[model samples]
Target: VAIMGRNKKTLDEAKSKLGNGAVAHQGDVTKFDDLDALYAKVDDKLGKIDVLVVNAGGLTAAPFDQVDEAIFDSMSDLNFKGAFFTIQKALPFLNDGASIILIASIAQSLGFPGMSVYGATKAAVRSLSRTLSAELADRGIRVNTISPGPVETPIYGRIGVPESQIDGMKDQFREKPLLKRFGEASEIGTVAVFLASSDSSFIVGEEIIVDGGIVNI
Candidate 1:
């Protein structure tokens, strides 16, 4: 297993938890050079990659009217451009038949006041999966996306929700999903594992919504 992030400390911590065999590379997906370094490390340590998960992204809540150019570019650079180039550069390192899993969001299909830009980027990722699936089919590779709803993570804090108000915000969001709660990170991981494994061999260019029925219900 190999993981890449911008923080060495966080990367090392994750590497510890993921086991000693997991390779942790410190780099930003938004930077082409960083991505190159990441893949180079992967090639040196792991040989060919069988699964590539493009999960480096974030959200900054701002109403459409208040979204500035910086906000727009930041979202696009990391979400859309980052995911695109990450996969493009991984082509050489990916073994034939490898699975590429993109982490998108359910907001792509919804109308949220401060989520316009974020949703748009996620929608782009979902679209990329379909086109790339066809483009990579000749090599037996499968491209898919997992659009998670409200999962338990640090997204709320980063999106401008105050620390004190996070629990309250979660309470309000609980009503959005039919499950009456936010999803666990492990729940999303399980789906990614399935998509990465042979269990989902036939699934391609698909967007699996692990949203606790939020989008459907």
Candidate 2:
């Protein structure tokens, strides 16, 4: 497995955790030059990759009226543009039967407050999966999106927002999901692995929502 990230410490830690089966490449997905260099290195080392998961993004939200261009560009570049280019650059290095999984969110359809821009970025990813799956079908490369709901990540604390508001949002999120709890990272990982395996051979261009029935109920 080849894992790429911007932080060297995090990359190294991931490499250590995966043992000898993983290789870490430090690069920022937002930069085309960085992606090119990373893929060149990957090509030299592995020739081709069997699975590509685009997970380089963050949560940035603000009310439509308060959202500035800087915030807009920051989220767009990392969430959409970066993701698009990552897949594009990986084309030459993607094996014929490779599976491409794009990470999206339930926010795309939730119409949550202050999430318009962030939701738009995720909506674009879901749309991209449809077109990309069709484009890569002839090559047997399946493309899909994993739309997760409120996973137990430390993102709320990182977002530049008040503690009370964040806590309130979390409370509302917790009460709404039928599961009555946030999803674990491992739950998402299992879905990803299934999508990358032959188990999902017939599932192409589908956006699988692993959000504990949040969207439905």
Candidate 3:
């Protein structure tokens, strides 16, 4: 297993938790040079890729009226452009039957406050999956997306939520899902694993929503 991130410390920590089989590559997905280096390292260390997950992104929240040019560009650069180039750069290194899983979000389907730019970027990713699947079908490579809801992760804290209001925010998120709880990180990982495996061979160009009925119910 190989992981890439812009932060060395967090990358190292995740790599340690992933065990000895996992390797960490420090690179920013937004930079083409960095992506090239990452795939080069992957080819040198592990050979052709079997599974490619374009999962590097973050949430930047602001009302449409208050969103500045910097915010707009930042969201587009990290979420949309980064995902596009990551897959493009990996083409040569990907095996013929490789699985490509893009991490979208339920935000793409719903209108949430302060998420206009963020949501639009995710929507673009979902669209990319459909088009790419058709383009790569001749090569036997499957491209799909997983749109997760409110998963339990450190993302909330990183998003500038006040400490005192964090629990309240979580409560609101829990209520959005019919399951009445936040999704575990492991649950999302399980879905990704299934998509990566041959079990989902026929499930191409589809977005498997793992949102606990938030979108459907």
Off by over 4 Å in 1: 162-168
lDDT of 2 by residue, 46-118 (tens): 7798999998888776889999999999999999999999999999999999999999999897898888889
Model 3 Cα displacement at 13 (Å)? 1.6
Off by over 4 Å in 3: 161-166
Candidate 1 positional error at 208, Å: 0.6
Clashes of each: 0, 0, 0
Q: Where is model 3 poorest over a 10-residue stretch in terms of lDDT? A: 157-166
Worst ten in a row by lDDT for model 1? 160-169
Q: Against the hidden reference, what TM-scores do the models get?
A: 0.96, 0.97, 0.96
Better of 1 and 2 by TM-score: 2
For candidate 1, write residues 79-164 as lDDT tens digits: 99999999999999999999999999988988777889999999999999999999999999999999998888867878965677
RMSD (CA, Å), each prediction: 1.3, 0.9, 1.3
